[model samples]
Target chain A: MKQKTLALLTLGIIFGGIFLTMIVGAWTTENTKTPARYTTGSAEGEYNPEDIRGSYTLGEVSTLFDIPTEVLIKAFNLPLDTNPDTFKTKDLESLYSIVAEDIEVGNESVQVFVALYNDLPMVLTDTYLPTQAVELLLSLDRSWSQETIDYLNAHSVIVTISEDSESDKDSALATNESKEPDAESTETNNTTNNSTSTTTSTAQEATTAPKTEPKTEVTTETTTEHKEPLIKGTTTFQQLLDAGIEKAQI
Target chain B: MSKLFKNQPKTLQKKLSIRHYVQFFFFALIGLIAINHTLVETGAGIPFLSDASLHALCPFGGVVTLYNLATLGTFIQKIHMSSSILMILIFILAILVGPVFCSFVCPLGSFQEFLGKIGKTLFKKRYNHFIPQKVHDVLKYLRYVVLILVVYVTAKSGYLMFADIDPYNALFSFWSDEVSVKALIVLGITAILSLFVERPWCKYACPYGALLGLSNKVRIFKIKRVEATCVSCNKCTTVCPMNIDVANKTTVTDLQCISCMACTSEESCPVPETVTLTLEPLNIKKPVSANLNQ
Candidate 1:
């Protein structure tokens, strides 16, 4: 080929390849959607659930809950299947009532989850649900009580709670073993005696007779629990406080 | 006679032209200012013009700055707005003056020219030949594409992309403790390319050169080859730093011509007033003789 002809051919091939690549790129981009990851404690401003992807689709909880699908999606961050306009209007009242009841009872997770389910259209498989739930929980700064922790552990939810606050250190280390039937009554009597001794000690000076009595009561309580090997290993408030400080430094 | 005219032209026995001295003085002044800014411990960083900022002011600066800004938004983001504008204006002036920016103002171009001079002193000639024109022309378009992409990204995402790899920033950054690894890499590449071909970046890679060429076509001051007075020696083209055929055409305003005036110098081409600086209309004169030596 002549040099000019060869140059034109080369240019044609180069441009054609670029055009094809761009078309393929656009097609692929539209088909594949990657779900966004949510993080905790970082949502500093007003909690807009709409900003959280895969939360809610429409206002209707029944059609995903009712109102409009757009409204529900903005408010709750849910995933939905169908168009909001096609949703049955009759289901709106029942879904709204259910959501309201759940919210009043302080079922925040269930309300939010329902909201998300209604709005976002993408199908979140069962495999990814727990991970998403854990992320939502962490972001909301909701602490897990012992019951909640046990439930999550049983369900194999990979949850990581932030380190305990300084003030909660003493209570965290306190051991609560199942009390024996006879031990409960004795414990109540011991608590009454200890309270009375504490009151008297505060009114009197350290050298007075009443001040020494509280020390004896405390010793007596320890001796009763000392008989049990499990109770003997239980940490006191002071010991736990010391351990927390040491741990923080390390 | 040969010993007396070793570095001097046989026709014009002049020590150094006033124009050369003036250019030398201006270069020294700019270099001193750059050094001062680098050394000043005001805890305020070194003040230098970014390519993008330069592009906004002058056609040459604008083209170079635009090209860099398009490719390296992150680097330009750090440049002060005032300095950017000043550099851009300087670039515009350079367009009118035939790449006076590269010869006198552009720190990177000046440094490369200095390096080329050192190479010439050692080797007594150019270390290598120019890249093929076809390949050079194609690669030149890369700067434009890079500029477009960078500008788009910065405009859409509010990012500065070109500031990182601009040679000017790389040179000034060495003094200011603000050298980016990316900028250094680009500078290294430009330097390596320069070793093989004189002013490789200016000839083949500089988008600014392309812009200046446009202004140079209508430039008031231009190198005019008087073919009637010319012997077909090809000496003018041989000594041209930018590799333009200064002896053949009435006007030498090719895109690759940096207006370094090396061809116009007496030592390079021993033709008295053959290639003179004039304000004449372009393409009026015809090619008289072919200088095959070039």
Candidate 2:
């Protein structure tokens, strides 16, 4: 009822509430395993490349996933010499706004940007890239120079296919021979090299091996290895991956 | 023209009152912040200050999220955690200072004050001239109704219904696609009405103001009139934007008092120690001492 009493009471409520929230917040933050939302940096520790979100900057992502920062910047058409970690999806949103408004700026499709920069399964929709991203990508002018194509190849899709014909299986096995004897238990350096090369180079390297004397047969096999399953209607890049296509092959 | 005006002390003299500076400071601060947000969105950005935009800085968003959290057990996704913290800070300030945020910090309030200045010049003697006292007394209660509706719909729908109609959001987000047509219309009407009525939206429609106004009844520090020194001069009553009857009341218990301090100023009151804002000390039998002033 008295003014002093009321003032003290009000002060008590404020200090008390603030203390409670701080204590709770400190404890919750200590226990939290997930990265804080809306921030980007490597000092926060690494996360799964597959699980990477739009809020992360290119530099943070480059360090975590070990993707080449230059390749990614080029793929996204970012201004040269940008600190990858310094820019995030929020910045990209800024770029999008400029492209829409300012005549001085040029436009790029966000779908193309995401697809080429993030080699993992982000922006996917089961069989393909996300539908909205796909729609945007359709109108984009993707100037895939041969080198850019190689970078994309190295970061390409997973192999979930099991329905290959017996002969197709034979060729897939043949490509694994260049892998070192010890690490062949899972995949090896050979597959990475094969996966990173152009389609013709991979085929040429596969055929020229001394163990394979059947050159014409190997050429036909390589064509079937790539072209046959891919031409199927509705088969997306992801589906090609599901059918055992590598980045180099796709 | 009167002896009272001549007797007004020079201590509170100002080309611009504290409230005017506060209004000017906040209006400029918020405008610059809004521009920063837009520039960041457009990629001509500098990595400094805060990356969170104008909407994140609004405390009212936090208030709505708190209501949604209490009633629906889920926080609105669009409302940031920073907003919730800001809401708590505002509540703290209200309890201590009796809704000074309405008079000083809230950009919308400052905007209304700016328009009110233009109205004062254009209408001269007819400034704040549209509404009668009787009609205004009844209409001022409508903000409470709006408060309830905003909380209810936002909780029930699990979405921010208030953002669809909030004029502050409209002002900051006018160029963005997120700006609601209804909100823009409300903003237009509020700006126009500001010319005829002081703080039209704050008095009659702002749910956040309705919530903060409650602090006037129970806030710790308050503007109090010293009856021993008080004259029957009604100068304090004329200066109050919220129209509290400052001369008639010993303690400003009116819910509409925004703690702007115009009434307590020496220029407005014409006497020192007549009006003060402080916690009432325990049964004092003598005049205020030097230690008490500290």
Candidate with top DockQ is 2
Model 2 chain A is weakest, by summed lDDT over 10 consecutive residues, at: A99-108
CAPRI quality level assigned to candidate 2 from its DockQ score: incorrect
Candidate 2 per-residue lDDT over residues A75-178, each given as its tens digit: 44343445565565334433421211111111123223443433211222111222223223333454333433332232222122123222333322223234
lDDT of 2 at A153: 33
What C-alpha lDDT values do all the predictions have? 0.41, 0.56
TM-score of each: 0.44, 0.53
lDDT of 1 by residue, A1-250 (tens): 1223322332343335434545665211110111122222222221322222212223233332333444332222222232443232222222221211111111223333442333221111111112234334334433333332222222212111113312322222122254334332233223211000000011111121132121111101111212111101123445434434343432
For B137-178, candidate 1 gives per-residue lDDT tens digits of 576566555545555564543323465666656665555434
Q: For residues B1-294, could you state the per-residue lDDT of candidate 2 as single tens digits? A: 465444433422346754566567667766777766666655665466344555566767777777656643434545655566667777887887788778767889888877877676566556664777788789889999999988778765545668778899888779875578999999999999998888899889989899999998888778988888888688788667776779989989787777777788443788877887787445547856886888
For all predictions in the order shown, the interface RMSD in Å is 19.2, 10.6
DockQ score of the complex predicted as candidate 2: 0.03
> What's the CA RMSD of model 1 in angstroms?
25.0
